[model samples]
Target: MVRKLLPPLASGFLFGMGLTISGMTDPGRVRGFLDIFGDWDPTLAFVMGGAVVVMAIAWRVQARMVKPVFGERFSLPDRTDLDPRLLAGAAVFGVGWGVAGLCPGPAVASLALSPVYAAPFVAAMLVGMLLQKLTMERKVSNP
Candidate 1:
């Protein structure tokens, strides 16, 4: 149980700490990054680039490994094709991120740092997720 939980817990903790330290928890900072036509902040680019680099290395390591360092099997996304649902979801996510300046990761981390402000965002996010699930279920059932 501890083994199963510890890796995820530690990873999340480290990710949250990184977000907080990188000023990603600050909506103003994120908004500034989104403001490419105006006072654009490039810091988030560096953060994202660093993440990409890290993930690239991780992917390379995974390619050589038979199984994950902490799991029964490496659960991976099987889909390689794009659909309307995927495109729409990505669009909605981008719009929401631009408007709110807080993606799920920073919003979740902000729960511990600034719950007063984070609560509504988190609640709405959960509601949105539930709605999406139900919509998808209905579509599948009807089709």
Candidate 2:
């Protein structure tokens, strides 16, 4: 069990650290990034660009590997459809990000820095996740 969990736990810790180090956990910085008409900050773009480059390399490596180091097989998303549900969800996500200036990742990471401020965002995120799961499950069962 420890072996199975270690990789994910380590990865999450590292990701949180990166978010903190890059100042992504700061709502002000994130809001600044979104304020294109005003004092827009470009740090998030650089961070995202670096992440994209790293992930591109990782994907190339994954293409060469038959299986992950700790898993029997890779569990990658195969969805490519542009359905109404996807569009609605994306619009909702964008609105939430703009309003709160924090997505799920940065919100969760911000818990370590300011639990009081992060609590509401995390709670709302969990509620949204649960609602999505219940909706999907009901659809699958009824269909």
Candidate 3:
């Protein structure tokens, strides 16, 4: 259990550090990025670009590896084609991000800095996840 938890906890810490360093832990900073016509900030784009670059490199490394440290092998998503569900989810996520200015990772990190807004943001996120699970369960049962 300790072995399983360590890597994820370490990764979360690093992710949180990145958010803090990039000023993404601040809702105001995120809101500024969302505001295109008024006091817009482009920092989030750079952060995202950097993340993409890192993910590209990491994916390459993972592909070459025979197995992961804990798991037998990585089970990546098989779907390469975009569908309506994917597009709809992206749109909903974008809208939520724009309105809340706090995605899951950063919102959890913001808690360390005592951001009161993070509580409700995190609560809503959890509720959304639960709803998605319930809907998926219903679909599976119906099908």
Candidate 4:
């Protein structure tokens, strides 16, 4: 159990810490990044770039490995086709991120600092996720 859970826990802890340290937990900072037309912040770009570089290396490592060290198999997305659903979801996510300045990672981390603000965002996110799951399940069953 510990072997299965520890890597994910560690990764999530590191992710949360990175988000907090990068000022992503601050709505003002995130909003500033989104405000490219106005007083835009460039720090998030650097943060994003760093993440991309790290993930690129991780991907390369994964390609070399037969399976994850902790898992029997690596569960990864297999879909390569771009569809309307993907575009629509991206647009919705972008709008939500811009308006709220709170994506899931930062919002969850903010629960430690400001439950009053994070609680509603987290609740809404959960509801949205549940709705998506139901929609997907219905489509799969009907198809």
Candidate 5:
């Protein structure tokens, strides 16, 4: 159990540190990025570009690997085609991000740094997640 938890714990800590260092925990910074028509901030774009480059390299590495360094098998998203449900979910996500200036990662990361912003957002996020879970369960059972 300890061995299994260590990898994800370290990864999450590193991710939180990156978010803190990159000003991703700052709502104003995120909102600035979204405000393209107004005074826009392009810092997040650079951050995203860096992430893309890193992930591209990681993908290349993954292609050659038989299994993850710590895991038996790699779990990856298999879906490629966009449909109405995906589109709707994306639209909702974009709108939520724009309005709140904090997605799940940043919201969770900000808890230790900016509780004022993170707390309410995290609470609301938890509620939303609960609602989603219950709704999905209902659909699964009904179907």
Candidate 6:
């Protein structure tokens, strides 16, 4: 169990450290990124670019591996095509991100440092997730 959890835990710790170092833990920095008409900050774009590069490399590495260090195999989402639900979700996510300036991962990480911002962010995120789940459940049941 320890072996199974260690890699994911280490990855999460590194991710949190990156968020902390890049000022992603700061809600004001994120809010500045969202602000286009006001004093805008483009630093978050650089951080996102860096993350994209890292994710591309990680994807390549994972593709080459037959099995993950901890798991039998990586279970990735099978969906390859976009649909209305996907598009709508993306739009909603983008709007929420633009307004709040904090994505879920960084928001959760920021909780350890700043509850004043993180608490509301997390609460909203939970509500959004719950709503999505309920909607999906209703659709599934009705259909």
Clashes of each: 0, 0, 0, 0, 0, 0
For model 3, the local distance difference test gives 0.89
- Each model's C-alpha lDDT? 0.93, 0.94, 0.89, 0.92, 0.91, 0.88
Q: Give the TM-score of candidate 3.
A: 0.87
Rank all candidate structures by their lDDT, best first, as comma-separated numbers.
Answer: 2, 1, 4, 5, 3, 6
lDDT of 2 by residue, 17-117 (tens): 99999999998998999999999999999999999999999999999998989889998866576788999999999999889989998999999899999
Note the residue pairs that clash in candidate 3.
Answer: none
Which window of ten consecutive residues has the lowest lDDT sum in model 6? 73-82
TM-score of every model versus the real structure: 0.91, 0.92, 0.87, 0.90, 0.92, 0.83
Model 2 C-alpha RMSD to native: 1.5
Each candidate's root-mean-square deviation in Å? Answer: 1.6, 1.5, 1.9, 1.7, 1.5, 2.2
The best candidate by lDDT is: 2
Q: Give the lDDT of residue 6 in candidate 6.
A: 86
The order of the candidates by TM-score, greatest first, is: 5, 2, 1, 4, 3, 6
The residue pairs in collision within model 5 are none
Q: Write the per-residue lDDT of candidate 1 for residues 1-143, one digit (tens) a residue.
A: 99799999999999999999999999989999999999999999999999999999999999999988887798787667577888999999999999988989999999999999888889999999999999989999999
> Can you write out model 6's per-residue Cα lDDT over 41-121, one digit (the tens) per residue?
998989999989999999999989989777786888766757888989889888877788788888989899988978998
How well does candidate 4 match the true structure in TM-score terms?
Answer: 0.90
Tell me how candidate 2 scores on lDDT.
Answer: 0.94
Off by over 4 Å in 1: 78-81
Relative to the unseen true structure, what is the Cα RMSD of model 1?
1.6
